[model samples]
Each structure stands twice: as C-alpha cells, then as structure tokens.
Target: MLPLALAPLRRLFLGLALLLPAAGCSSGGGSGADDAVEAANAQNAQKIGAADVTEKQEADARFLVKATSNALLEVELGKLAQARATAPAVRAHGAALLQSRLDLLAALRALADAKKLAIPPALGEDEQEAYHEVSAQTGSQLDKHLMALLVKTQNQDEDAFDDMKDDAYDGDIRGLAAKYYQPIKAQLDAAEEAADAAEKLP
Candidate 1:
C-alpha cells in the first residue's frame, strides 16, 4: 500500500514539471504579439502624419502664389488708369502681364482638380476666357504697364498722374486685396507650423 501511494505522487510531480515550460512559452508568445501590434500601430500613425504635412505644404504654396499674383495685378491696374501717355507697346506689355495672371489661374485650377479641391468662387467664365486669350497673345502686359508709367513719369505731369491714380484705386479694390492677402498669408504660416508639429510628433 505504501509503494502504490508513492508511485502516484511521483507521476503527479512529473506531469506538473512538463506543464511548467509550456505555460512560460505561452506567456512569452502573448508578449511578442502585443509588441508586434504596437509597432504596427506606430507605423500607421507616422504615415498618416507625413501625408498631412505634404498636403499642407502644397496648399500653402498655392495660397502664397495666389496672393502675390493678385497684389501685382492691383498695382498694374492702378498704373494703367493713371498713365497719361498711352503707347502701343505699353498696352501690349500690360496685356501680357494680365495674361500671366490668367495662366497662373489656370494652373491653379488644374492643381485643384488633381487634388480634388474646390474651385475658387471668384474664378468666373469671363476670367477663364480672359486667361485663355492672354496666353495666346505675344507681348507682356507687365512691361506695358511699366513702360506707360515710365512715359508718364518722364513727362513729369504729377497732377494728372496723381488724379489718375486716385481714379484707378478706389477704396473697395484696395480693401478687398488687402483683406484677401492678409488672411491667406496667415493661413499659410499656420499650415507651415502644423507641418513642423507633425514632424515632431512620435
């Protein structure tokens, strides 16, 4: 009876010893699975952040270009109205500058389409037609504006030029240009900061 009881105890000890390593392996496997999941999640987060930064950079560039173009156009239009001396070359150059603006607008539209962004409300049918016509023209409108101003300045008729300047720039045009430029510049700066922040994260 004593031997039989001792045999049962020995068998029980052997069985427990075998199960110990398997239990340890299971715990290690669970830890490995957890580590893998964490690494995958981290990788996904990084990709998402990078994509956001890229998108922001593109948008900022677009806004900057638009603001700059609009400002230049306003200045040109002011000069055109004020110039007392009108030459064919001056008009041609002015037309060319206007055309450049159109080209820029077209490019913007194409980019927006590619990115699935909305078309600007200000871009109307006439604007599009004007842009196309400008692209087709040979001369630079910017040069024309400058030449006209130079001719007027050479004449030294300050009073006439001054009066034209007043007529050219109404309160409404200047105000609108400033309003658009300022807000877009602010947005661009913020987008840049956001991109920098994304780079820092993780």
Candidate 2:
C-alpha cells in the first residue's frame, strides 16, 4: 500500500526502533564494565605508587647488583687461574685474590639482604665472555690472558669502589665501599704485578 521510497523509510525507522531498546537495555552493563576497568586502573596506580623506590635507593640498589656480579666474576677467574695457570706468581696471586673476593662477596650479600636489593646469581654477558676467552687458552697463553683480564677488571672494580666510597648517598653503601676500596686497590696492584710477571714469561 506504501510508495517505494516511503517503504524504505519505514523499514529504516523500524530497524532503528529495534536497535534503540537493545542499546538502552545494554547501557547499564556497559557502564558496569567501564566502572570495573576504572577501579582496576586505580588499584594498579596505587600499587605502583606503593612499590616505588627513591632515586638514591635505586642508585644504591643498582651498585649492589653490579658489585655482586663483579665479585662473582673475580671469584670464578681466581679459581680458573689457580687451576690452569703455569706461573707460580699467577697461581699465588689468584689464591690471595680469591680469598679476598670471597670475603668481599659475603659482606656484600649481607648488605644487599639488609637493603632488600636483589642480586643476580651469575655472571653478566661481558663477564661470561671474558671468562670464556681466558678459559680457551692454555699454559703461558692462559697466564697471559688471565693477567691481562685481571688488570683490566681490577682497575674497573677499583674505580667503581672509589666512586661509591666518595659519592654513595646511602650510609651503608658508603661504608661498604670504603671498606673495600683499599683492598680493591691492593688487588689492582697485585693484578699489575701479575701482568708484568706474565709478560716476562717465555
């Protein structure tokens, strides 16, 4: 009974009319979902805020992490030197260094526990690479490689400890740094001597 254009208009209106009730019926559920999402966002924000650490705390934590890894590397290298080095000077230096590094690591672990900082349980990528490189050599080659690596690493470690001793914001971290700086310096000297000895070897 309707005109063609008017029939299409009627169908369009009927479809909208059908959709309107469905939209209205779903509005409450949509609002509830939005509220749940908002609440979850608020809770996450609160949790993040609660877990946030201060900048100084973060610095101290980072130092502890690096120090732990360095100590582990030194310990492993020291063991390797004792087991694989051909020179008496290298082996004796390794033994002394190993004992000192073990003591340092023990102290560092205690301090890290007190600060609630997490330390990695093994060597970092660069440290592993250095270890593997030194391990690949034999006899005098191993001694040469080990001494060179020790000189480089000990210098780096000494510098780090010196900086931390002078500049650390945390009192405990400063104390640890001060405690180790002299020993680290001594180790660096020993490493240099070992390198010299290795160089003189035939």
Candidate 3:
C-alpha cells in the first residue's frame, strides 16, 4: 500500500533494526570471551605459583631433615668423646664440637619451626648403631674409634653444606648453608687433626 520511495525507506529501516540486535549480541559475546580468557590466565598463574612454593618447600625440608640428623649425631658423639677419651686434646675437641653442633642445631630448629616442619626426635637406626659401637669401646680404643668417626662425619657434613650452599632452591636454605659451611669445614680440619693424634697413640 505504501508509495515506491517510502517502501524502500521502510525496508532499509527494518534491515537496520534487525542488524542492531545482532551487533549488540556480538559485542556482549566478545566481552564475555575476553573475561573468560583473563580468568583462565589468572587461574594458570595461581597454579604455577603454588607449584613453585611446593618445590621450594620440598627442597628446604630435605635440607632441614638431613642437617638435623647430622647435628644430632655429632652432638651425641661429641658428648661420648668428652666423657670417654683419655687424651686431653680429644676431650677439648669434643667440647668445642659439642658447642658448635648445639648452636647449629638451635638455628636449624628455629628455621624448621618457622617452616612448619617437624624435626626427627632421635637419631636414625644407622646412627644409633654407630653410637652403640663407639660406646662399647674404652680408653685408646674408644679414642681411635671416635676420631675415625668424627673425621668421616665431618667430611660428609662439609660436602653436604657445600652442595646445598651452591644448589639449594630456597634462598633461606642457601643462606643457611653458606653461613655454616665454613664452620663445618673448620670442624673437618679439627677432626682430621684429632685422627692424626689418635693414630700416634700406643
């Protein structure tokens, strides 16, 4: 019923009206897609952060456990040598070693506590066996045994600290190793000296 010109104008307006709703829908969908992409990225970042934390915690825990065990063994053996050795040099060395181990253990405990880790309450089976074997000896025999054990253990401790100082994943763990490696090396030197002295004994 409309005139020819009006008919074209009405068709054009109807076409524009139809396209407007579709365009609005397309814009909203684009915004939603962007939001989804952002959320996924944030989620992935959170997972990566958690993984990194877990890895560092695991590394730190391993170092703490091993260091604690070593400290405990050294403390026990130092006390034994202090009580049983006939040589004044051996006894003095034991006292000094005991004090050093105690200090190291105290620091390790504080660090472990802050990390929410539980330290082993006693020595391991192998350590206990070693302690008993040393306990069975007396006099020069005990001195020889103790010095040998100290030399071996001090070397191991020095090596462990050296590795951790260089390779630990956690900054704090690396710092701890760096702080103690020199002292451990010094202990190793003392142990070697004690062993030499023990070898000279009749």
Candidate 4:
C-alpha cells in the first residue's frame, strides 16, 4: 500500500519506465549485444575482402610468369643463335628477334609491376634443359637447331598472344597483346621460312 501523498509520484515513475523502451526504439535501438554482432559481421566481411584481393594478385602473378618465361626462353635462344649461327641471314634474324623480345620484356615488366604481378628471371625446368641442349651445339648444326626451335617457339608465342588478347583482364596487358600479335605472327612466318631453307642446306 502506498501513502496518498506518494501515489501520484509512483504512477508518474511507472509511466516514464514504459516510455523508455519506446524512446530507445525511436533512437535506433543501440543494444550492446546488437553492436557486438554487427562488429563481428563487419570484421568477417573485411577478411573476405582481403582474401579476394590476395587471390587475384596470385592469379595475375601466375599468368605474368607463364607469358614472360616463354618470351625469355626465346630471347635466350636468340642470343645463342647470334653467337653460334654459321649463316649471316640466320644471325641477322636472331638479332631482330632479340630486339623484339627485349622491347616486349620491358613493357611486360612495367605492366606487371603496376598490376601487382611477380615474374621470374630463370626459365622453368623443361625450358632450362632445352636451353642447355641448344647451347651444346656449334656452327651450322646450331643454326639448324636454332631455326627449328624458333619456328616452334614463335608458333607458340603467336597462339599465346592471341589467347591473351582475348582473355586478359588488365587493360594494359590486353593492349600490349593487341599491339604485339601481328609482330609475333610475322616472326612465326619468318621462322618457318628460315627453318625450311635451313633444312635444304648441306
């Protein structure tokens, strides 16, 4: 039982208690548990975003390595052809190839850096073995082997460039592929012509 004088004060306090939850609802309901859950969800989303970025970087790095390694192999073999070729025509062709590869390599490295990709200086295992095999030969024998190697290598380059031009996600890589496609195709044709002629030589 309440005293008569305190009864009105008690009723006013009860009315205010009823309105407190409604006021909290109007103010967007900042419960501590709700805040904790939201914070946890935001943290998870951030982690997922970071993972996506890392995965993309890794994928771009792999593609850059694949494309650039093959180009580097050709450049190495062209250097060998320059030193070991008996025919002046074949030596000249090797010089042109070396220049083309150097130009493309510079462009690729710059583009890869901008795109967060890492490339290797050494060729992969099988290619390194192929390089060693070519390096063992001398003179006209080297010329024949180098010309055949160039024919096969340039054919591979032509196809890879075409595929990259179609599939590349980066604007610069796509542009580079588009820019180099015709040159690579021309090299393939030249290599084939040289290989055929070399095959006829004694």
Candidate 5:
C-alpha cells in the first residue's frame, strides 16, 4: 500500500491558499480509517509547526510540488486508460479524470509561481505547450463525461460506479499514478536537495 506520507503535507497545504477549497474531500469517509488519516495529518502538521516560518514555507513548497505532480500524473494515466476503455461510459469517466489532472496541474503551477518556486528547465516550453493542448481537449471531454457520470451515478444507468472503479484500476493504476507523478516530484525533490546543500534561499 502506498504510504500516507502525503497526508500531513495535505493539511499543511490547507494554509497554502490553492489547496484550501479541495481539502473537504475525504476518501473512505465515515470510516475510522478516514478519521485517523485526518487526525494523523493534523498532528503531523502541529509537530512540524515548531519550525520557523521560513522553514515551514520551504516544507510546504516541497509538499506542494510532490502532491501537484502526483495528481497530474494520475490524470495522464487516466487518459491512457480511457483510450482503452471498451465502454463509452468508462471512457468518458477517463476523460473526466484527465481534466481533473489538468485542473490540478494548473493549480499547482499557480501555487508554485506564487511561492516563487523555481521552474525546472525541462518543463520550459514544449512540456508547457503539450500541457495546454491536452488541457483544452481534456476539459471539453471531461465536461461530457462528468454529465454522463452524474446520470449514471443517479441510477439512470446501472452499475456505473462499479464499472468506472474497475476501469480506473484495470491497468496498473497505481503504477501509472506513480509514473506520472514522478516528473513533478523529481523537480521539487531537486529543489529540496539544492536547498539542503546551500544556505536557505531568501
């Protein structure tokens, strides 16, 4: 199982302005596990709070970089999975997943820029253009898919959620999620590495 290393980082991100709105989403909610995740995340943040503001900001930025990358990676993997989905409904769901990725990347970009985090050179031009192109197309596709999911989940269509969940995980969703998230994480990880090697940036 993937560790919940991202949890405390998620809540420290609550103060990040960019992540505040989405924090309400709780996976496996109403379960003891969900409660534990939240509590654990909160406690982790409090523990890390002993650090000075500058240190906190740096840590927050590092967390943002990793989380944002992971999210985008998941979306890209979803797009690939969508291409293989035999069911139109499932494919549409995949499109929505891709759109979500674009939204996440956009948010992360905004947050990183806001925090003055340095952009990696590789993502300078070509990567950005591809992101824009994919984002535009995927956004349109996701709108259609989400509308369909709404109908399906409402019982207008039988067994939609089950189908979607199955399709989402069919082809190594975990692996793909990790693969896509790596680039962004690597960049942030590099920044952290640099920070560690040098005096803290002003």
Candidate 6:
C-alpha cells in the first residue's frame, strides 16, 4: 500500500542500486573495455612499426640489386671498350671504369653485409644484350656508341643516387649514398666529357 509518488521513488532507488556494481567495476579492479581498446591500439602500433621496418629493408635490398647490376654492366662494358674503342680517351676511360669497379663493388658488398642483404650476381637480360652488342663492335664502331652509353648510364645512375641519397630509410644506406655521390659525380663528369669528345672527333 505505497503512496503513488513513493512507488516511483522506490523504483528510482532500486535502479540506482542495480547500477552501483557496474560503476564500481569500471573504477575498481576490473580491466574494462577502455584498457582492452588501449592495449589493442598499442599492439597495432607495434605491428605497424614492424611492417614499416620490413618495407624499408625491402627498399634497401632493391637499392643493392640496382647498384650491383650497374656495377657489373659497367665492368663488362669497360672491358669491351678497352679492347675495341679506337679513341685513346675512350680506352683510358674504360680502364678507369674497370679500376673504379673494384672500389664500387667493395663498397656495395659492405653495405649489403651490414644490412644483411644478398647482392645480385648478374645483370638483367636487356643489359646483357646491350653488353653483347657493344662487345661485337670494333674500332670507331665501339668508340662513339660506347661513350654515348657511358654518358647515358652514368648520368642515369647519378640521377638515381641523387634522388635516393636523402630518402634512404636505413641510415647506413643514406651514409653510403652521401659518400659515393661525389665519386659518382666525378665519374659522370668524365663520362660526359668522353661523350663530348667523341662527338667532336674528326
């Protein structure tokens, strides 16, 4: 026999009593959904970081492959130029390329080792075909084309290295790029001069 107003007040008090345990669970020893969500976010962040490192390693590996391909092509082309070019400067440039190969290979290998990356041992098919085409030529046939190829390839490499030097994800690769850029620039200059000289030849 409660009063009409007393009935709603009793119901309201009962509802509050029922809600108290839930409020305590949130504030007390229970690890609520907030903690679970935060933990999940932390784990996801860790996964993302790991994924980023994997991507960076892959890019560094690609860099090594490209460098090795260019180096091998340069060495092979240099030998052909040395043997067949009629121009003395082209032959000397070929000799210089061959000499530079040793230093370049060592530097590339060191970078690969430091990064735990495997260096590719051979050139791609297009480059091998280009190598054979150059190898089959002799005298003036080899001179201008070889010089042109040198200018093209060396300039392309310089361009790539310039673009990559600052953006390398690995600090070591960045350092290597910075260190090598100057030498590659010098090489590119020589290749340009050789190309210009060949064009000027009588």
Q: For this target, which candidate reaches the highest TM-score against the unseen true structure? A: 2
Error of 5 at 36 (Å): 32
Instruction: Extract clashing residue pairs from model 5.
Output: none
Q: Give me the runs in candidate 4 sitting further than 4 Å from their true place.
A: 1-50, 53-61
TM-score of 3: 0.71
Write down the TM-score for model 4.
Answer: 0.68
CA lDDT, every model vs. true structure: 0.34, 0.71, 0.69, 0.64, 0.39, 0.64
Q: Which lDDT tens digits does candidate 4 get at residues 96-157?
A: 89999989888877875554334544465556667777778776778888888788778878
Clash totals, every prediction: 8, 0, 0, 0, 0, 0
Residues 1-202, candidate 1, lDDT per residue (tens digit)? 3354234323433433333321111111234323322332233233323332334333333343333334233234334523421334344434443444454456544543332223332322322333334334333443333343333322322222233223322232223334333433443343234333323433
Q: What are the per-residue Cα lDDT tens digits for candidate 2 across 7-34? A: 4333433333333221111111234333
Q: Report the C-alpha lDDT of model 3 over 83-182, residue by residue, as the tens digit.
A: 9898877888899999999999998878655434445545655666677888899888899998898888888889889988987755666888999999
Error of 4 at 84 (Å): 1.2
Q: What is the overall TM-score of model 2 with all chains considered together?
A: 0.72
For TM-score, candidate 4 versus 5, the one ahead is 4
Candidates ranked, most accurate by TM-score first: 2, 3, 6, 4, 5, 1
Question: Candidate 6 clashing pairs?
Answer: none
- Measured by TM-score, how close is model 6 to the native structure? 0.69
Off by over 4 Å in 5: 1-55, 87-89, 119-202
> If both were scored by TM-score, which would come out higher, candidate 1 or candidate 2?
2
- Higher-scoring candidate on TM-score, 5 or 6: 6
- Per lDDT, the best of the predicted structures is 2
* Higher-lDDT candidate of 3 and 5: 3
| Deviating ranges (above 4 Å) for candidate 6 | 1-56
RMSD after Cα superposition, model 3: 24.5
> Rank order by lDDT, top first?
2, 3, 6, 4, 5, 1
